[model samples]
Target: MRVLIVEDHEELAHTVAAGLRREGMAVDVALDGHTGLERASVNDYDVVVLDRDLPGLHGDEVCGRLAAGDRPARVLMLTAAGTIDDRVSGLGIGADDYLPKPFAFAELVARIRALARRTRPALPPVLVHGGLRLDPSTRVATRDGHRLMLSPKEFAVLELLLSARGAVVSAEQLLERGWDEFADPFTQTVKVTVSRLRRKLGDPPLIETVPQAGYRI
Candidate 1:
């Protein structure tokens, strides 16, 4: 999943971004609310980690604007104020969930996962197709009990295809979900990565190319 983190706290933001990246999620960071809103508006993010108090615009405004905008990404409001009123106000303003400061990383991850589950119609974390099994959490792909090594981007593409299970996924959909906003969709990067992934997967041809469409597992 791709996530946009809008937080002014440098250390905390880096920590959260790093943790999410380790979990095999693509993450982008914005230090202020305006940039956060802009990034959230342009990108296809699974979730947005927005701070309630921001420099350019308040988190509530950001959430409201996102909900009113063309592309609405799920918002997870974060603030130092831990009160029932604060949580209610954040949610009332269109935030999907609220997480107070100094919170446990596990809980934060869980909340993000929950929001992601609700926003994106994906298969369970573990996706299976015949003898192929993919563990998203561990970023591991196994075929017939043998572990497969894959690059981050390659793994992401395979995960997207496997999640769809046999249905064809369009290139636009793969670019939106498998890669970040800056990725060049028109380029051959996706094809190259898929080629490499196929080589790694070896026989049986797990990934089925859909010509102009995309790929299916």
Candidate 2:
């Protein structure tokens, strides 16, 4: 999933970003609230890890604006304050979840995944279509009972295509959902990834590309 972290603590933010990346998540960091708001506005994020104490803009204001927007990313507010009142206040501003500072890394990851699940329609744990089967929790993919060694991007692209249930998935949509903010929009990265994915999936050409449209299975 793609996530945005808005934190004033640079070290903590980078640490979290690295850990999340290692966990197969696309992450972006914003040092303060203003940058966070700007980044959040530009991208389609599944979750936002926002710090309550910010420099440029208050966290509450940031949360409020996002919550009121047309398509708001799920907000997970973070605060050092662990009081009931504190969480209540954060939720008052429309945060989907609240995490007090000094939280467990595992819990944070779990919460983020849970929130991301809410963004998309309910999907089965194992996504299967014909000979293709993918177990997301295990990060495993198989075609006709044979294993496929897919890179992170390739795996993400295939999972997205499979999840579309044969509906056309545009190149732009794949770029947004499969890559992080650092990905250059003008780059041919998406095309390259899809090409690699098609090779990996192999014979009979399962993926169909429609000219000027997109890809479908």
Candidate 3:
């Protein structure tokens, strides 16, 4: 999944971004709310982790604008305050969920994944096709009962392709969702990842490439 973190705490923002990236998510960090909004405007994200207190623009206003805008990214508001009133106000503004400071990293990851599920049509928690099985929660993949060791990018590409349910997914879509903003559009990242994934899947190739189209499972 793609996530935008709008936190003024530079260290915190980068730290969280790195963690999320390790979880196989495409993450972008914005040091302030205005940059957050600008990043959100151009990129499609599954979730936005917004800090309540921000510079340039307040997180509350950012959430409000996002709620009113055309994009459909779920917002998870964060603050140092942990009170009934604080949470109610944050949700009242537009946050889909609220997290207080000093929260467990596991809970944050869980909440982000839960919010991401609401973004598009629901799919099975564990995706299965043929003899292939993938569990997002466990970050495990197996083919014909044999385990497949995949890199973060390869796993993400496979997950996205499997989630398509036989529909053609363009390279651009893969790049947008499987990679962060730093990825060059002209790069062969998607192709390379897919090629690696196919090799790992072994014989009886599952991914099909369409000339001038994209790829499908």
Candidate 4:
């Protein structure tokens, strides 16, 4: 999943971004609300980790604007205020969920994933096709009861393909979702990752390449 974190605390923002990246999510950081809104406008994110108190424009306005916008990205508001009123206000302003500051990193990750899942029609918590199974939460994949070792990138690519449920996923879409903004658009990273994933999937070749289109499973 792709996420945009709008938090003024540079250290915390980057730390959260790194953790989310390790979880196989493409993440972008914005130090203030204006930049956050701009980034959100430019990218198709699955979720936005918005800080409730921002420097300019304020997080409330950002959340309200995003709620009014056409983009479907879910919003998970964050704040140092932990009162029930604070959470209710955050949700009233359009947040899908709220997390107070000094929260557990694991809870933040889980909340982000949960919000991302709600962005579209819900899928099974554990993805499966035939004898192949992938537990995203555990970062484990198995085929016919045999485990498959996969790199982070390879796992991300496979997840996207499987999430599509057999729809053709273009290379550009894969790169946009699997990689962050810094990725080189002209590179063959997607091709290489897909190739490695196919090799690891083994036997009965699951991923299919559509000429000039992209890949599917």
RMSD of each: 2.3, 1.9, 1.2, 1.0
- lDDT (0 to 1) per candidate: 0.84, 0.88, 0.92, 0.92
Model 2 regions more than 4 Å off: none
Cα lDDT tens digits, model 1, 36-95, are: 988887788888999999877888899999988867478899999999998998899988
TM-score winner, 2 or 3: 3
- Work out candidate 1's RMSD over C-alphas: 2.3
TM-score of 1: 0.86
Tens digits of lDDT, candidate 4, 12-91: 99999999999988999999999999989988899999999999789999999999999989999999999999999999
Candidate 1, lDDT over the whole model: 0.84
Worst 10 residues of 2 by lDDT: 116-125
Question: Considering only N, C-alpha and C atoms within 3 Å, which residue pairs clash in candidate 4?
Answer: none
Which ten residues in a row are the worst by lDDT in model 3?
Answer: 116-125
Question: How far off is residue 166 in model 3, in Å?
Answer: 1.7
Give TM-scores for every candidate, taking all chains together and pairing residue i with residue i.
0.86, 0.90, 0.96, 0.97
Positional deviation of residue 107's Cα in model 4 after best superposition, in angstroms: 0.4
Error of 2 at 67 (Å): 0.8
